[model samples]
Target chain A: MDRNEPLDRVKNRRDSALRALVSGVPYMTWLGVQFDRRGDELTAVLPFDQKLIGNPVLPAIHGGVTAAFLEMTAIVELSWSTMWEDLESGRISPDADVPDSLPRLPKTIDFTIDYLLSGLPRDVYARGRVVRSGRRYASVHVEAWQDNRSKLIAQATAHFLMPRG
Target chain B: MMVGADDAGRDEQARIAQQFIGAIPHARALGMQVEDIGAGKATISMPWAPHLVGDPRRNVIHGGVVSALMDTCCGAAVMAHPERPRSTATIDLRIDYMRAANPGQGITARAECYHITRSVAFLRAVAMDEDGEGPVASATGTFTVER
Candidate 1:
């Protein structure tokens, strides 16, 4: 096997694992989470639901719910890579019991949310990009938009501390 | 300076806080129930669920849930005072998860507005999954009151 072969296989398995993970979130399932990956970019599309409505007149999606959606999406994406390494090492399996210390990235060192436009009653999408990934820390940038307008509803740059095993 | 009280203003504060909860479904789904309010302070609680589990084996509530609970409680606590009419934005929230949220437990969020000066409100909350004894998480939140 080529040296890069294991890397490629792990990446592929990561994508599949992400899909299965998103399907498990009941709210994400209700909203229709669409996973789109091209290279290192990950996009999660969440359809709007009436229950997420925060304001009737302005029809803004509740901020907390929107934040939750973004946080979960980012965590799932990060988990894929970490879990793949564990699987390759035979430390964990999809069917096997998850260890007590399930992998954790550094706690969010910080996150800044800039609410540019309010999320309306239409499907919203969040695009996340790994700006930099290192041994002990990783930085991710995420943007939420609608209809390709890039309304820039919320942009978050989070620093995650990677756990040292 | 003498502190003044307005009965109507107090009633309006309660209504606004209630509307805030009514606006968010997940807050409702979490069963976040407000207990009472007094002098720029509020207390709220939410029930724990199997779905709330983060590390399923340990049955801990995800840290994000703890953050959200603290955020909600702090925002309400800040706005509970009659004098602050404008909306507030969370400038920053820092949480320290102390222990795992035991399975089959509910969380109570207790928040108090310690100071309100000019345009900033300082608040703190502890989300207890059992009673008020052992906390699942504790947080300090800062809010900027819109002028």
Candidate 2:
């Protein structure tokens, strides 16, 4: 963020950064997590996969995987907020000096989840809100929903030890 | 661990635990195995695999994998409860991760459904790595009991 780039370049850089962020985590790729990005915001998507179901009888996505999706969203969103600020401040330039690899994400301290309803056999989406983010700590709340946003499949709150900038 | 008075009852619970793991597609994907089970308790383990890694450079498995294992094990414990339990669903789970699981060490989780009411069961679980001296994560969860 040392200097402002063209708006188009900023958009492309943000998209690439998010993609790189997802690709950086092998488990996220294994879960087939994708992101729909708008500027600095992100909504994580977990595509339908039979391998994700924990209950064959109910044909529902595993509760653990739902938790994973929420955790991943919280993580990426948390990391992105700081990185985005760095990008805007021109502290690092992806075009010239930023390393090919992204910085390490914050370490998770604790995660608590509440399952509202069984996740149906369909695509699921999650959005993370950064309840608080500081130089050394962050707290995030994430919720996953299917067709009806009002009806959440699950929601989670996590506290992470943010990596020092 | 609560051991059933009769060996036959113990074996039957073990068989049910195995069948339970086999029935879940996600459990299969994780290569989960039934280690032990009895009335109101269950133990499950899963081996480490590349696909389960959260941080490849660090060789750390994903937290979600452990969460899933604990969740499944908790439900299994509820299913094996002495009461008229038929099926179960996770209502809420709180997991305090002490540390990341070792890279190549398999993880084992043991859960005990200590109490059950008309429609709810309470369980506590611990996840340990073969290489660790202490638990990798400890969890307490509430689940719905469907009799």
Among all candidates shown, the one with the greatest TM-score: 2
Per-model C-alpha lDDT, please? 0.64, 0.85
> Can you write out model 1's per-residue Cα lDDT over A68-123, one digit (the tens) per residue?
56665666566555566675565654422333334543445554454566677888
True contacts kept of each: 0.10, 0.88
The C-alpha RMSD in Å for every predicted model, in order, reads 5.2, 3.0
Report, to 2 decimal places, the DockQ of model 2.
0.84
The residue pairs that clash in candidate 1, if any, are A106-A161
Query: In candidate 2 chain A, where is summed lDDT lowest over 10 consecutive residues?
Result: A92-101
Regions of model 2 farther than 4 Å from truth:
A1-4, A93-100, B1-8
Candidate 1 residues B1-147, lDDT tens each?
001135545455555565567656756755677665557777777777766655454555555566667777877777765566366666656566566677667778888878777788888777787755677677776777765
In candidate 2, residue B51 scores what lDDT?
83
Tens-digit lDDT track for model 2 on B1-147? Answer: 122334457777687668767878888989999888877888999998988888776888888888899998998888877774767899999998898888777899999998899999999999999976899999999999886
Assess every candidate by TM-score. 0.72, 0.93
